[model samples]
Target: MTASRFPRWVYTEGGEPDPRFTLANERTFLAWIRTALALIAGGVALEALSLPIQPGLRLVASILLLVLGLVSPLLAWFGWAASERALRCGRPLPSSRLGLLLAVGVAAVGVLVLVGVLVGPVGR
Candidate 1:
């Protein structure tokens, strides 16, 4: 209930005081969840398409999606926590290295899949 608990001024006119910052943070978290779901769907599609699916490679992709899905909510919560703290303390939001890390990881998996398809058995 205290002003220190949330960023209410981020949303108000002239920055006099508002709750827009918290609102924005919530929106961001929702976007992350959507991204996680998309990744999961991609993994499912890979499995459904009968890709080479060598046990190890398939497992990697599946685990990537599963981990992403599992971590999304946790990341979102952390983001909210940081946002709240930043707003209260009048400090900048925390930097996020995970976004870049996730992007690179996903790209790596895609490349692995491509390589597998190229080198895999052709008569399957």
Candidate 2:
């Protein structure tokens, strides 16, 4: 009997890798998902709470966090699939293309928060 996997494209081409490696890849994917959830939570918090921040800046920072949150899951899935494919093919793992972008986005959010805090709420 032939076993069927959900993602045929990923499973069809490459050989099965060690189960441990596959589990590790799954863990990494979950970690990325967790990070994405944190970012999304932060965005919601910024808007939902009555924090003393410049209104416009807070909105911008919240939006930025949301965008990063949206992208992270996609990167996580791509990374997971790529790593799985490499492991099965005996090829070197691929480097993350969006990891740097995520870092920069988080940093940008930090800067926005700092500026908003320093400036205080305007027109409030």
Candidate 3:
């Protein structure tokens, strides 16, 4: 649980960025958190529906989405910290790997849902 392992854990190291920029960064983080919450909610809803798909398929899809939801907040925090640091140091902002993960993960979820749908809503 060292700060080195989690940049956002150490929040006061850098010089202050412009208030507006800082506020914007905070908002961005909040938005990502919201997105994460939505994913978690969707996952729960899917599991609750107990979609007539195979039990294993429903479980796997729900678990995958839930994991993604858990990861999202961590990603948001890391991104916020990196951007804040770059702003303070006047350096180029760090690349966001989370953005790629989100895109790919969402596509994967879509595929899983499509497979379930094609298999028949009430399942075989």
Candidate 4:
């Protein structure tokens, strides 16, 4: 039995390599899973808060949170796939487009919330 030099299967149609890359890939997958779970948690927390919230606001928040939760995992999977491909190709890691998009989306959501607060009635 002999360990291979490069990350296998990636280079050849069917080959094996050091386990380090495999472990790294597993870690990346776990990170993505955690991210996905966090998004789901956020959705649940938002819905939970809705218990005492006005129906309309609660519904809107719940919907938005659920969308975030559902999308985060998909985005994570897409990003991970691209990253893994880059690793296999030995190319410089792809740009952080996903991170930037997430950041922008979050900021836009914050702005929308601010607008809602400002445009809506003053607190009771």
Q: How well is each residue in 1-124 modelled by candidate 2, as lDDT tens digits?
A: 1138856667776778899999999999999999999999999999889999999999999999999999999989989989888998999999986689988999999999999999999875
Candidate lDDT scores, in order, read: 0.67, 0.90, 0.80, 0.57
* Clash totals, every prediction: 3, 0, 0, 0
Number of the top candidate by lDDT?
A: 2
TM-score for predicted model 3 compared with the true structure: 0.83
Q: How close is candidate 1 to the true structure, as a TM-score?
A: 0.73
lDDT of 3 by residue, 1-124 (tens): 2344445444556665788987998898999999899889988988899566655566777888899999999989889888888887778888875888988887887788778767755525
Candidate 4's displacement at residue 60, Å, is 2.7
Q: Lowest summed-lDDT stretch of 10 residues in model 2?
A: 1-10
- Order the candidates by TM-score, highest first — what do you get? 2, 3, 1, 4
Kindly indicate the candidate among 2 and 3 with the higher TM-score. 2
Pairwise lDDT winner, candidates 1 and 4:
1
User: Candidate 1: lDDT of 53?
Assistant: 47
Comparing 3 and 4 by lDDT, which wins? 3
**What digit string (tens of lDDT, one per residue) describes model 4 on residues 43-66?**
577557524444455446556656
Candidate 4 lDDT (Cα, whole model)? 0.57
| Stretches > 4 Å off in candidate 4 | 1-18, 50-55, 109-123
Instruction: Compute each candidate's TM-score over C-alphas.
Output: 0.73, 0.94, 0.83, 0.60
lDDT for position 83 in model 1 = 66
